[model samples]
Target: MKHEFDSAFHPADIAFKTLKLAPHAWVPNNSRLPVLIYRRAVDPSTKDLGKTFEALLAGNEWLPQWRDSIFDYHHFHSTAHEALAVISGKAEVIVGGPGGEVVSVAAGDVVLLPAGTGHCLQSTEGRFQVVGAYPEGQQWDIRRDALLKEEIAAMEALPFPRSDPVAGRKGPLLQEWT
Candidate 1:
């Protein structure tokens, strides 16, 4: 899956949607940042969705950080924005907080989470896998549905990632986030 980011390539070619959040419990949903969902960002039938997705994100400066063996409970990061590219299998995910929205995602899907957005794996098909990454120089901190005053403040002050994990600086992420 060699992609040439030349004249023929445009970030808008990949379709995506933005999901806004309101304060929910200790999740402290990011009032300014929205979760991004890139539907079928990659072809599910591709031979190496993980590798391709990783390369795509890295190319846009979203540093590949971990393999998506995500936990089952709801959680969020207050210090960094994150991205998850589904490589194989399908899963039901809950986003926002306890009262968040639930979405079904499968291979070739990419989900971009801003700092302070809550997410959790509700269920999954066998052999589920994903590639996770973060913006350059960003570190992540995990928090459950309980938060401190300082944590809430920090989450509110966190800056948006400089680039979209799948589409670079000019991608919809900047347009929607900024």
Candidate 2:
């Protein structure tokens, strides 16, 4: 299928980081799945950054769920994993609950959070717009706290996506998740 930006032509050697977050306080961050972070996953200079990210993720079977700024409070999803692409400005985001990893993201960067992983916005520059997505069959739930058994079970039960939202079939999500 021809895409708007040819699937947002990204670099073959797109650099990424994977974090396996342990449970923090009441937040049951994923024990089995590490959050995936891709730096410069797409070209920031594109005329239409959000559209590029949407098409790329859609092609990979991840739905372009919403376009907004990250929530200012710490929270997480229990039912569905999430993919976020920065389309405007920059942000300092905290992932894996309070005192979790603090990441700085800018336009063109992408973050894939496993179910039950915590995330919140710390601060931003410019417009701070983000495009969020979810795997094809999974819908998201906001949870700041969860019963250990229930949250862990729900998170563990979720299936890993077939392809990486940014890296396509060869994206790190497949290898690391499985």
Candidate 3:
């Protein structure tokens, strides 16, 4: 089979050729500017985003590393299930539970959270490359730093993550809050 390259290429062909697979290693420019190498067009082929689920690319948005201190630490909600697929570079995916317990995720890893769960990220290496998803009617509720700090304190006060084994606790082994 021979494939021809055209300035006017179809999405299906492109997605297929790339195997629609996550990048082997998530490497981003030193500036942390995300590069949109590929994106799944919203068309008839891909319309359904099951209940409490969504899929969208987190395109590289211009942000001054020095000036943009917005994404320091926060937890947002996406009415529906949320998934972040690492395309390149190392990113720290912190999936926080009712308590302070957090599960740490690394590059080339896909982190999924139930609807209304608390999740956030702090780029540990390179630029953060991730594809985020939300339920049909869900919009990202980005919490402010002050709010996040309060939540962290609230969660820590109560022994939650440590109380339950089922609670999904992942993120950096030890994050300094002070």
Candidate 4:
């Protein structure tokens, strides 16, 4: 669907929730990666939700991303924050760690994972697809439930992105994370 605010989309129009985390066995010691969820951010009637979501992220400076399905196992990125926008189908995702919370997400939903926040695809419907990306110039390091001391330190030292993947520099992402 088209919106009058499309040219001047305000962050206030979008409702976001944050998930705080503590250092787990596999995850490292650092500020709880802010988990921001934007529900129904896209219009269901819109075709090609994947490309649209990618464009939104890219516009906000979350670049060098990929389009694919989420892995059905627990994993975390110690080096960079990640954003996942559900383009099609539905799935249950575990966030924060193996014992983290399970969230049911579908098309038009967006999830922002801070560095070191563990996530996995618990279950999925027929065709689950997500568009994933990172902040400009950031590469991803995959880590399961294990980490070395230096790895933990590096994760703790990782910098927050200047802008939100979905929102811009003045979005809720910066407000909650920084």
Best by TM-score: 2
Error of 2 at 64 (Å): 0.5
The alpha-carbon lDDT assigned to residue 66 of candidate 1 equals 80
Cα lDDT tens digits, model 3, 35-76, are 111222223232342211121222211111111111445454
lDDT of the structure predicted as candidate 1: 0.80
Candidate 4, residues 1-178, lDDT tens digits: the string is 1111122443345666777778776765245556888777776446998888888889888973788888888888888889999999999998877788898898888888888888889999868889998998789978876777787787777777878777676667776776
Q: Candidate 3: give its CA RMSD in angstroms.
A: 16.5
By lDDT, the better pick of 1 and 3 is 1
lDDT of 2 by residue, 1-178 (tens): 1111122367566788888899899888889888888888888999999998999999999999899999999999988999999999999999989999999999999999988889999999999999999999999888877657866776788888888898778777777888
Q: Which candidate number maximizes lDDT?
A: 2
RMSD of each: 3.9, 4.5, 16.5, 3.7
Order of candidate numbers by lDDT, starting with the best? 2, 1, 4, 3
TM-scores for all candidates: the values are 0.89, 0.93, 0.36, 0.89
| lDDT by residue for model 1 (47-84), tens | 98888888888988899888866678889988888898
- Each model's C-alpha lDDT? 0.80, 0.87, 0.29, 0.78
Q: Pairing residues by index, what is the TM-score of model 3?
A: 0.36
Locate the minimum summed-lDDT window of 10 residues in model 3: 27-36
Report the candidate with higher TM-score, 2 versus 4: 2
lDDT of 3: 0.29
Full-model lDDT, candidate 2: 0.87
